[model samples]
Target: MTDQTDGGRRLSTQEAARVLGVKPATVYAYVSRGQLTSRRDPAGRGSSFDAAEVADLARRSRREAAAPAGGELSVRTALTLIEPDRYYLRGVDAVALASRYRYEEVAEWLWTGKLAPGAVFTAPPEALAAAGRAVAALPEHSGPIDRLRVAVAAAAVADPLRFDLSEEAVLGSARCLIPTLVGALPEKAAPSWPGDGRISRRLWSRLTAREPDPDALAVLDLALSLLVDHDLAASTLAVRVAASARAHPYAAVSAGLGALEGPLHGAAGRLAHRMLREVLEQGSAAPVVAEYLRAGRRVPGLGHRLYRAEDPRATALFARLEELPHAAPALTAAREVATTMARQRDLHPNVDLALAVLTVSSDMPPESGETIFAISRTAGWIAHALEEYQAPPLRMRPTGHYEGPTPPQPLP
Candidate 1:
């Protein structure tokens, strides 16, 4: 058994097969049957079972050589990698990766099978000009995300080649849309040398306001990388469902953004931001937090569905924030509030809370909070769309139960 500390390493089925003196196909069968545990590699290949877990499985199998009636098994479409507990991309901890790389680069890696490669740097002038028009068309009061949503949809429409979700078209759209969403015409492109190893981090910094103080942009880049994908989150599920209708990536992703815009999925950032604003405006983070507890309102960005301890992504962001030069009084206040709230209510900060503080600390425009989340999430949306396109069709159909006495007197 490998030590528990070998967190990211994996042995191939061929290698494990040699260890077990079995065929490689048999090893792969062990994985599909869940009799062996394995993980995806950086190249998207699922390497063979964990030595420790596989040993355990072998032990149990040997002990129970002939039994079949103890437990039931079922086939599942959740094979889409939607399980919250173990979901990841290329063995990179999704949450950990979010805090480890840049937003643009993360999207690129997930889509085109490369990490931090240079964007197809020469977007047609027409594309940029069309994006500018989309920008101009937005109401001045609309926030960055709203503008992005509109612009992306517009770009897809204007392209006329959008239905071509051929591998080439999908990849190109992803590359162009990534930058366009992060920054419009005037936003500076980060100084990433093509194929530069740190291009993802550099691009992340570019998305921040012109003068981000604590290097929150860097922290955000890492966070985005981790969060950029989750197997089939509700919004991602929406994208997949829409894709089952033969929707292209753009159409699918647009549907995803709509689902994300809902409160339960996309609006956590806004919730946290509003809570923090109330705390700052009222001169105390306590009463506001306490009232929420008293009212049973969900404390925005505290608990997470997958993480039980502190969310690793939140921990990573907070750790890097200590050295930020652009720290605000409210950011400090919010942290203290977070600490106090934790002790007082046993609640801890979640990703949204951390990001809310970051947005405030960055002096970003108010709407920028949701905008950033959506922007980071675009990668996930696109990824889910691609996955759906590759998957078997129409599995999302829901069955309806007959009710109300079989439609009553309709036959009369």
Candidate 2:
């Protein structure tokens, strides 16, 4: 094939692919991502790409090695951008949104491209009854998140039209889902939700036995919004992988919960919460911090993969904690623990620390942080499931190269 030049040296898709030492699809991906400049064919037959840009991209792609953990799998997502210190959810500043918006509002924005004004979400009475039965039927010692898992399963069973994958249908389910999940937690008294029935208000009633205060409730709200999503986390990936199998949205969220059961992901805050409680009870963080370090265990909630400095979410939550008079002891203990970690190990606290502090300050259940994380992440799981549903099914299958002993020849 003859190469074509339009003013500058331009290459057709095939020629550009050859120059870049990549496939035609990769060339298109580069063009779509704006890594390569392309224009319509002057002859109106095929597309033309800038040869110089193609060459430059080729050089850069060659120098870049595959990321160690991901096996060189490149996933293109427009949902979240994770930087060293901050992240954006669909181009909105996530930290700022956490402070300025309600959890449900942010969840709607994440699920749908546009935020709907005057949106209100209420759980269906029967679905709530189903979820409540599921939660109450569990063992008395069942954790908050366990109740949530059962509730999700029950909700899915109750929804007859859950197989529908249309945007309107999925969003409709999610609108009820948040409330149903929150309502499923065992109520401490009559009318478990005493406030305006916002998710934050309902969630507070579920997690704590004590009455709610505005300061504590504000912290929980911010915590939920901040934890709503991070790009391709382990749990989020699990959700996407499930959705790629064409699983219903509820099933996809269940998959996310399964992955989040691990300590490294969802339960990290529980560990931090325990340690913070120890500090508050002992009236000093020095011995607890020293013992944790001496055991050669990295302090949980002190570091994160995506931030070199302090986590922006943690910073925002910690700032809000300063205004609560009742949280003074817990806040001081958290501050001491953070200062000790930073001074001794040069590591900064992540959002888990702030979450633990919030739980302790509000006198919520010790496992409440994990529950908040799971609930907040449900929005992200649903959003990812929606995105995956639009793609070809089972697209996330991974092939493994043989590294074991060769098998015997087949008996013919």
Candidate 3:
């Protein structure tokens, strides 16, 4: 039933659920997540939602459901599913999984479907040495992604079983290659431990020279677990395409890295970092945001395609950042940016903004978030590659729709 109120027409909980095409429990979940607003009925009947709001939410749901138009390639996998304001990995709540388990443990579960406590990925000495040499060969000015590309190539050459497509062989290679990639990065700080530690611990030294507090280190680890996989993202699709062509796991990861280089795919964190730094320097987000609009640039880190509300990853990371004393200023700046933009449009903060807060507060460089994303997402890429390996080879080819002048009149 709909009731007319001062704000507008309002729908009861059941009506809202029907409009959203979800169960009543899901509607309540949305309300709890701040994805939907609920008001108590004046008659004390039940909770009510704004009719316009429910209609808008229903439209977004429909658009998301029909995103893949005709002829669009869709691959089936038991990996990840992104919904209105939440995502799941292998049927587990990703945020809960990330918060409860270490990054390595979550990654192991994603790869093999079973949790192994205290899971550790150790790189083979030869592969590590090879990757280090290749990374060193790059020009000093090369970015982290460039160095990672070189490292993966060198590691692949060092593995004698690189061509093996067997699940066992691929899994073994993934475990070693991830650690090798992390180990190959040039360390910015002196070693706290003698070369053996979690991937997050080793990566910390490379990202910043500051000694990590337990809370900060925990946040980094949480970030890694949350980012391990995210459906078939653009880079993941690139990885799948390579795997479909029988590319080895290392080569498939390299393809993902190549795709990640695009500005739209992986560079948002750096841009967000710069924006937050400017907000800190200028003491307000209003002028900074105005300048961005004046220059005809879309504000970065404000929205996500997959999420209409707050990004679940951003929500999780922001909650953790709140507990860190050092992160206060950057976190405030992030919120200010979001609030300032919200006055004009109702965009929410995405993971890039949260990552920028972590990097900016931790004294890490702007590109550090991209590096973290690449490293963490390698597990996901490998997992997708594993799935692709089990399917028929060359199944990803799609017929091109050619639209041009008639072919017979090409006598130029």
Winning model by lDDT: 3
| Local accuracy of candidate 3 as per-residue lDDT tens digits, 307-336 | 989999999999999999999999999999
How many clashing pairs in candidate 3? 0
Model 3 accuracy (lDDT, Cα): 0.91
Q: lDDT winner between 1 and 3, please give it.
A: 3
- The TM-score ranking, best first, is 3, 2, 1
Q: Model 2 segments beyond 4 Å from truth?
A: 1-70, 190-193, 409-412
Error of 1 at 76 (Å): 7.4
Error of 1 at 270 (Å): 1.6
* Candidate 1: residue 405 Cα off by (Å): 5.8
* Candidate 1, 225-344: lDDT as tens digits: 656766557777787788667687777777877887777887887778778778878888778878988998877878777755566666776777766756565567667667766785
TM-score-best of 1 and 3: 3
TM-score of each model, paired residue for residue: 0.70, 0.82, 0.83
Candidate 2 has which clashing residue pairs, if any?
A: none
What TM-score does structure 1 among the candidates reach?
0.70
